[model samples]
Target: MNEQVIVTGASGFVGRCIVKALLVRGVGVRLLVRDPARAAALFPARGVELVEIEDLFTASVETLQTALAGGGMLVHAAWYAEPGQYLDSTRNLVCLTGSLHLAEAFVAAGGRRFVGVGSCAEYDPTPGHLGIHTPLRPQTLYGACKASTYQVLEQLLPGAGVEFAWCRPFYLYGEGEDPRRLVAYLHARLAAGLPVDLGSGEQVRDYLDVERAGEMIAEVALGGRCGAFNICSGRGQSVRQIAERVADGYGRRDLLRFGARPDNPQDPPCIIGVLEET
Candidate 1:
């Protein structure tokens, strides 16, 4: 844990958690961020270094290499994840390209280990339960881009003598979650004593808190594990069940109104991850 690890998007939701987990484990961290002041305010802990990049998705490989120097490992958690619009945004393509550039820089900088964050969307959701062996059939631009990065880096990084791992997270909630996300929205509404609308609430998903997900990703980065790993709760819960559970926290289960909002026809009916390890 003493080795220095460079983390991109250190100011982001998942990224910030990952940085915190690493620091808690006594690992030195170097944050690659667009805003150094913001990152510094987020992590007022010792042994944290912030390296600013004007735009990670547009930074030159040489610039990234210089910024990545001295860090033996990297946890890449940055992406254009602007809630509602990110699913089909062209920014996914930019992120894909920039991630490749960052990988190139990592290799050039003599980095030994590279851990990238991915989403469960990289798999075909029709299967309901996803495992490491599941065939990838990403249905959206964001999933495609993530799957593409995994495929390319799976072959590219190892060939370049750099160890690599990909952490694919399922439905993540908890601290730092965007208000537009399901869990956050439910809390905002329920805490305010307002009615929370939802769809049929039948779709099943695997939910994991972002803090646990971050610890798992940090484990992957610090350990010798390679290839893809699922960061999930390993259990399924219906949307209704999750909503009710959140509502129960505020003693406002009656405020939850299922079927109030039309369900997105494109949403998969179920998505549960099969954890490969403890």
Candidate 2:
């Protein structure tokens, strides 16, 4: 009779919002956090509990599975954008293994309805010859790892009696996010009255608010059908457009600048995912 839920990456921007949504709906949330102190002390409501992972990025599947046995739903939001992996092909397997373990163990314990967050980067740059669902030919390490996880989960979970729901979120802008990220950084710089040095600004990205995405994810976890859903504003925004919006919102239009640094080769150019088949 325990209506409990477990979430990975609970201390992160989107993870926190998902936890909050569950809590607001009167569901007990068990957050798998690396460091509880790093989170806001007031994050947990009367029914919320924070379960710290003693060995992050190293815990066994059995360990995490047992942790999830008491949950009604699980959301895998934990990702390693860390530089230690160097985005190498071999390291991608390690990250993918950890991601799968969460789902595997959760299923082993009779819990299904696993929600995994995917990125727009997983889509093919052009559908010309490939069309849609084209094997996810990723360029960067992060994209490769995400792609790897998606395929394996789909193939393996069917045998385990677990259903998977993937949510491909577009560019999300919000507070308490890392400053190095594009939207968060631009918001901070514009708020600080500093010149926003941006690239060509032609790179259009699908943007969604973190809070809104969280609500959608919660709904999917409960009643969403199988397969992936594109969780975005269903619209795209360029870099310059985002800068201008932030400037206008913060009233700092004069601080916008262009042509800052050369774009990274790994950075996707105009990465916008189209979500079809609602």
Strongest candidate by TM-score: 1
The superposed Cα distance between candidate 2 and the true structure at residue 210, in angstroms, equals 1.2
Candidate 1, 15-74: lDDT as tens digits: 989999999999989998898998889999999988889999899888898899877899
Off by over 4 Å in 1: none
TM-score of each: 0.98, 0.87
lDDT of each: 0.93, 0.73
Residue 21, model 1: lDDT of 95
- For all candidates, the clash counts are 0, 0
Q: What lDDT score goes with residue 22 in model 2?
A: 77
Looking at model 2, residue 96 earns an lDDT score of: 76
* Per-residue C-alpha lDDT of model 2 across residues 192-221, encoded as one tens digit per residue: 778887776766677788998888877777
Question: How close to the true structure is residue 220 of candidate 1, measured as C-alpha lDDT?
Answer: 87
